[model samples]
Target chain A: DVKVTQSSRYLVKRTGEKVFLECVQDMDHENMFWYRQDPGLGLRLIYFSYDVKMKEKGDIPEGYSVSREKKERFSLILESASTNQTSMYLCASTLETGDNQPQHFGDGTRLSIL
Target chain B: SQKIEQNSEALNIQEGKTATLTCNYTNYSPAYLQWYRQDPGRGPVFLLLIRENEKEKRKERLKVTFDTTLKQSLFHITASQPADSATYLCALAPADAGNMLTFGGGTRLMVKP
Candidate 1:
């Protein structure tokens, strides 16, 4: 079975704090993604990496950045966390960069910015 | 602009019945559509995928139908049980090489016992 692990299941941070959310996948997938989910708004993509050191901006990438220094690790960085940034963060990966391939996701990190 | 709309925020159905969820998209064409199940406080789990070339796909009690002309996809769960209660999300992909997806808000299904 494919396992995508998020470093923190729950995190609390103050406004203007730099936040880093870590994720690792055991499957060694070529595609990795970061998404933030909120009520009524749905899951909005933040950033994605197809290869190490390569990143693409998703629909909502204004206050976020990503790093893929290694094949198994991907990190989402919030430059300065704000109250509005409080939401559920999810990480996902796929075996390949194909269209119909299902993505495996981590449990998620519930971030609360005070 | 590209957009995806789910049928509703929530749907309620009695156990042992069929639950139907709808996902509609506009201003874009997708090579395939996917359905995912997510429990409260958990990440979404892959359920089924249906391509444009295929009208329907099934996995046990779950079935998905895609209509490119209509730009719509329908997900159905047969003989649903209490355990089937969860939020279902639908996503659209342009082509195989591009895995970028536009996801709908999702429909939360609550199966009553």
Candidate 2:
């Protein structure tokens, strides 16, 4: 079974603090994604990486950045955390070459900015 | 803008009954659609995927149907148990998304014993 592991399951940070959320996939998937899930807004994509060293901004990329230093690891960085940044963050990965392949998701990180 | 809409209200069903969920999309033509199950405080797990050419797909006790003309997908769980209670999300892979999926708000299913 493919597993996607997230660094933290729960985190609390103060406002103006820097926050880092890490995701690693054991499936060697080339495509990785970060999303923030909220009550009514659903899961909004924050960023995605097609491969190592490549990143793309999603719809809600403001105040968020991503780093994919290696193929299996993708990290989401919040340069400065704010109260509104509190959300359930999810990391997902999918194989690069496939026909309608589904994404595998990590357990998620529930980050609360106080 | 691409949009996917799942039932915002929670669906309450008795055990041993089939639960059906709906997903509708607008302003986007997706190459395929997917369904996922998520428990509270957890990320969603991929359940099933249906392509544009396929009308219906099934696995175990779960079935998914996609209609391109209406831009809708339906997910059904047969003989649902208490363990099946959770939030079900529908996602779409837009042609321009580069393998990334856009998800819906999700419908929460509560199976009562």
Give the Å error, residue B58, model 2.
0.8
Residues B24-102, candidate 2: write the lDDT tens digits.
9999899889899999988899999898899999999999999999989999999999999999999999655668888
DockQ of every predicted complex: 0.73, 0.75
Pairs of colliding residues, candidate 2: none
Error of 2 at A7 (Å): 0.7
Question: Residue-wise lDDT of candidate 1 within A1-114, one digit each (tens)?
Answer: 999999999999999999999999998798999999998888899999999999999989999999999999999999999999999999999877434688889999999999
Candidate 1 per-residue lDDT, tens place, B1-113, comes to 98899966689999999999999999988997889999998999999988899999999999999999998999999999999999999998987547767789999999999
Question: What is the TM-score of candidate 1?
Answer: 0.97
Candidate 1 local lDDT, residue B79: 98
Stretches off by above 4 angstroms in model 1 are A97-99
Interface RMSD of each: 1.4, 1.2
Score candidate 1 by lDDT: 0.92
Which model scores highest in lDDT?
A: 2
